[model samples]
Target: MLAEPARKFQSLAMAEPRSQQRLPKRLSRLLVVGFAVLIGLMSVLVLNSVLNLRAQEARVAGTVELRNRKIELATDLLMATYSRHNSLVYQTIVGDPFEQDDHFQQFIKWGYEVGKARNALRAMRLDGFETARLADQDALLARIVELHDRISDLARQGRAEQARQLIAVDLRPDNLKFIDSVDQLEHYERDRIQAELDAARSASRRAIFVAVGLGSAIVLLACAIAYLTYRQMGRYADTIDEQMRALEQHSAQLKHEATHDPLTGLANRSLFYHRLTEALTRAGQDQLKATVLYVDLDDFKPVNDRYGHAVGDSLLQVVAGRLLGSVRTTDTVARLGGDEFAVILLGVGEASRISRFEEAIRANLVRPFEIDGAELVPSCSCGHAVYPDDGVGMDTLLHAADERMYAAKRARKGGAAG
Candidate 1:
């Protein structure tokens, strides 16, 4: 007959499960938190990479602009230099027939302008241009300079007529040839600039396309991760909520078990200490007096020694009930240990109130007990300690009360006539 009940009890025990089997709420939260953290980290990386790419693209674009400007300046300089050369040669050759007053001045001005243009070309051209092309251009420029010098010398000798004749023979052909060569060099430079522009444009287009593709991929990846993480976080949140509910219930049950004495269903030592601290805190805050009544059973050990541990336990339960009945509902009574109990009065009016509470506790503790229908008697020695006056802390108050209880016990022993 007992076998069925035992099996049912076993089933109940199994159904209830141990505390270890429950999943931790923190673990679920950690998974959600970790996923969010990783997603945030990845998002940051993607954004930083995109920004760096844009910065690089901007740098490339700036370089392209600078290269294009160089091409423009070089082209303009070549054209200006060529024009100056044409004017110089034409004036020296043809101006003798016309004999214009501005002929020498025009020649000198053109020479200066051409020189400036050549200097600009030298400054603007790329270093990597073919050495042979550069050398040919330099040779042509030198020839132009020499031809101008020859024309200048003829004019300076006051033989304008002879200068004109020499200009027709020497100045015109050399000037035209130099112009043609410079034209060729300009065309070559144009072609090179065009190629560079084309290459830069193509690279810019490719870079922009690559950046767009990569940025899109990163955004899509981030969105996908966010979506997945959101879904996962939802599940994790539910799991955590369930675990939290379970934990709260478990915690409430544990609180109940921890605070109450198992034998007498009264407050245990932990609860008493907590209540004492709270009472003391309130007393300090409100500037009121709080009392702690320390009670230790006097003859209870004799009962345990004469009868047994079981009988002593029964007597203690009886004593706890009487003690609880004697104190106000607001007061806290706790079992410290074997035959030891403490009471915390929330708001004590005065020192006399503590004396009255001690009197009530002693009266109840010394009352007779009926255990298993057998008459028994129990007596307890009491001690009173007040907070913020006699002691400032829980430990100090308890210690003071315990000392008084021991002192009372010694006095009673001395009066026993032993």
Candidate 2:
């Protein structure tokens, strides 16, 4: 009956003490949560960086590139103006009447180039300052063009001196004024480009600083979460180990309590039956003789009545100790309850050895018990039933031994009465 629990307890005891390889459930959850938090934080940072880069790419591709293209067109206008001025100067120096048509043709071609450049600039979207500056430059170019037209007329009519003189008197000063105006527009556009570049760089630096700060914070936060989780797991593992150890000790105590007598600390009735059954089986298989001794204390109720149950319990303990001392370690001694005790002896086929066994038990149990300042001498009636000579089965052998013990008790009472 007690075998199953004892086996379970034995298995539990044999297991390594408080060894836990698996993490606790709560700690596992905490680690999972920490991992998720890290993932979430990193994802946000990456997504934000991606978005910012995309925005910067859009600005660079759109407004900034367009503005730079506009600056290139302004530079083309400046180059065309300078080329027209050089063509007018060359026509002034080459003053042959026949070459006049050729120089005028060349002069008209350079003028067309300047007009084409101005038209292209006007076609694009222009700010107020760019429009006003372009208009002012156009007015100055018109004055220069009017003077060239007059010089062209003089040259074609064979008035070469008047054509050459018209250059210094009007054309040169007007072209110089136009050059200054174009330079002012170029400087303004260049300043705007530089300002735009500076703004972009400052924004980029701010974004980099913010991204770095947030990334560092997230990394530190993840590390802190990880460290806390590790510490918690350690504490949780220790707690689980402590509980496992406590349960192991409790199971061992329960196993002992289940099969042994509380007061005498000997095998109780359950264990007694179990041992007797095993002994009978072994002795029968070996074809060897075994002995069962059923012992009942004489006048044990009087001792309990005289000295109280405490002394009775003490006497029983002393009797159990003596019986254990008298027998070989291989033998079984048990308390069947109250003042009754039993012993099982296997492989004891000799008649002399069985007699010596009984004598030793009787001799030891007859000694005085001293407990709580009360000293008492006790006697017991013992009966033996040898296996096969008595019975083969466990219950049958036990019943035979019990009946013999009662018969001995009756004989002792008769002798006392006489």
- Which candidate ranks first by lDDT, i.e. highest? 2
Per-residue error for 329 in candidate 1, Å, reads: 0.7
* Candidate 2 C-alpha lDDT tens digits along 274-297: 687788888878898988988899
Candidate 1, residues 348-416, lDDT tens digits: the string is 748677777778877877777677666787777887788777878554576678778777877877888
Question: lDDT for each of the candidates?
Answer: 0.64, 0.72
Best by TM-score: 2
Model 1 C-alpha lDDT versus the unseen true structure: 0.64
TM-score against native, each model:
0.41, 0.48
In candidate 2 the C-alpha lDDT for residue 5 amounts to 96
